[model samples]
Target: MTAPLQGKIAYVTGGSRGIGRASAIAFAEAGADVAICHLDDEAEARTLVQAVTARGRRGFQMAADMGEVAQINAFTAAAEAALGPCDILLNNAGMNIRNPFGEITEAEFDRMVAVHLKGMFFMAQAVYPGMVARGGGRIINIASQLALKGSPGIVTYCAVKAGIIGFTRALAHEAGPRGVLVNAIAPGPVETDLTRARGPEWKARISASLPLGRIGQPEEISATAVLLAGPGGSFYTGACLSPNGGDVMH
Candidate 1:
């Protein structure tokens, strides 16, 4: 049987760990060659590349911080050189610093906006022309459930994530005409380094409040991403799929 993504090329940001790592592996397993970028953590990136290669698919890794436009362009160039034009682009690189609204500094807020909102916008811009030329492609941005329902101590995070959704929608309108589907994935509390950084108490409290009674796994999130990037997502664009354990039901 042919894989849904056979012969495709995928590019994933923040691919060193967590949802990004899992999604890259999943794409490879589905028969797509993958190129992933990380801010740092060469070891984790190497492991991801190995895992994808082990799946009998080509894998490439680059160290690039998404917060910088030049770095994003460089990473995309490297990916194209190594793997070819991207069929699926996953803008998942992000960071967070939690502090009370009054305590959060200007720099901290700027950092969050740069990484989440600015990065997502330009990354999409970088790949869009190629996608248009190819006649079709997929762009998936990783948002958060907090974007839908505000959270204490992370106002900047919430704002930027919300911006991601807006960006996805607007970009989808422009790109969809050119055969590029743009979407966002808003996940709830997941057992990733980012979420675990909130500490055990936060995790426990969140889990108790969630309908699933537990934080989600990276694999679960990755499955949703794979579906978005594969043939199954042919008709999906400008949609925000929230796999948030029922945290925010609309």
Candidate 2:
């Protein structure tokens, strides 16, 4: 049928797996060329690129750690060079260190902030100038349901995600006037490598707790990203869209 983002370009970080991978493909299917970067997983990244190209959209991939400013800059430059200036950006790259608050180390905390908050800041900075010059663009940041309602063991993660929401809202205030829309997505209990690491018992408990009585899939979350990137999200700036399976009803 008709493509909503036919002439657009999307940049997705941590696009080799989970939500990022699914979002990249969904964006391509919606008719945007996609550029993605991964920290390691070259094979998975390559496969994701193949999926994008198979959809008849241009695809670009590279290896870069979002936590490092140099790498983030390099990736943005390379991605824009290969796919042209980004029209949509999904800052989805991140990692978690789940433990009791008392057991959390300084190094672990630093890593979390570096990758989740700092990386998101610069990555958005890298594209903001162009989007402002071009008159508009969309930015979708990934937060977590925990950011709304905290989890016991993932204190740091919850805090960082909460920071993302604040960042999204504050950035929107500045960007909206200039035509760049910024927003955040807070998902609950999705099946990703991170969630899988939480173990089957944890999964069963989380699944049962959600009002939907099931865990979410990556594709389910990606649909939201597509909506935020396409014309449907034209007025969704600075908002936190939660596809949380009734996990955090507000």
Candidate 3:
């Protein structure tokens, strides 16, 4: 098979499981070395690392909470040391605390902001220089349909995701001349730990309402990430791809 990402280094945050894990494996399958970050899921990260290696690519994992600036910086450095300069960055790390807007505490709201919005910005900043030095690279941010349509009890989550889209567009403009492609993926109801946390019954009800009548799979989302990371995405930048089973039609 032709290696689209051969000789490249790809780093994915929160890759121990869910969309992050799927994207990391997809990048590896395309022939890129992978560096994955998991806050406290080293064991699962190890399994993912082994899987990436098994695909005939190099894989490394680091433990770091993306919500913390210090940890993110350290994680990036560790990944660089292990995987060389990053050629593709998948900013898949994010968290959402569901609660009525009136019940959202300052600290809880802050955590959501720190992890989803703040982390993506700072993480991009940390990796942009390397990508520019290399002449070109891809930065794929995982957003949500809620960010577009908004959702109850997830106000802060939606806010952060909306911020991600804005950030992607702005950063795309800034990074374009430098050869860095910045884009965001707004996935709909998907079957993952994140959705499970939302409640299984609620997950089903949401999926049933979708045109596709089914929740998305991690692998399905991973395919999109592959396109954004490979030659197929050469012309795509500053765009948000909605893989939400036709839920949020334009």
Candidate 4:
């Protein structure tokens, strides 16, 4: 049986761990070559590369800070050179600082925006032209459930995620006519390193509050990305798919 994404190339940011890592593996399992970027974890990134290659798919990895535009451009160029033009772009690189509204520092706010909103926007811009030239492609932005329903301590995080949704919608409108599909995934609380950093107590509270009574797994979210990038997702554009354990239902 032929895989859905055979012969395709995918670029994923923050692919060393968590959701990004799962998405990269999912793409590779679907028969796509992958190129990924991480902030500083060379060892973890190498492991991901190995995993992709183990699936009989080509893989490339680089150390990149998504907050920097020049670094993003450089990563894109290098990935394209190594794996071919990216057919699926996953803007999943991000970080968060949980602080109350009054306690939030300027630097923290800027960093969150830069990494999530700005990085996602320009990364899409960098790949969009090539996607257009290729006649079609998929761009998936990782948003959050907090973007739909505001959170108390992570104001900046919610703001930036909301911005991602807006960007996804507008980009989809502009790109859809040209055969490119742009969408966003708003995931709920997941058992990621970032969430785990919030401590077991916080995780317990969140899990109890969720409709599913537990935090989601990275592979669960990755499955959604696979759907969006594969042939099954041809008709979806400008859509926000939420796999939030029914945390915030619309």
* Model 1 misplaced stretches (Cα beyond 4 Å): none
Q: How high is the lDDT of residue 177 in model 2?
A: 94
lDDT per residue as tens, model 2, 166-214: 9999999999999999999999889999889889999999899989999
Clash pairs for candidate 2? none
lDDT of 3: 0.91
- Per-residue lDDT of model 1, residues 1-250, tens digit only: 9999999999999998999999999999999999999988899999999999999999999999888999999999999999999999999999988899999998998889999989988988899889999899999999998899998988888999999999999989988889999999999889998878879998999899999899999999999999999989989999999998999998
lDDT string for model 4 (119-217, tens) is: 999899999999999899999999999999998988998999999999999999999999999999999999988888889999999999998899999
- Per-residue lDDT of 1-250 in model 3, one digit per residue for the tens? 7899999999999999999999999999999999998989989999999999999999999988888889888989998888798899999998778899999999999899999988888888888998998899999999998889998888999999999999999999999988999999998888888778878788879878988888999999989999999999999999999899988999
Ranking under TM-score, best-scoring first? 2, 4, 1, 3
RMSD of each: 0.9, 0.7, 1.0, 0.8
Q: What are the Cα lDDT values of the candidates?
A: 0.93, 0.95, 0.91, 0.95
Could you tell me how far off, in angstroms, the CA of residue 118 lies in candidate 1 after the best superposition? 1.0
Stretches of candidate 2 off by over 4 Å are none
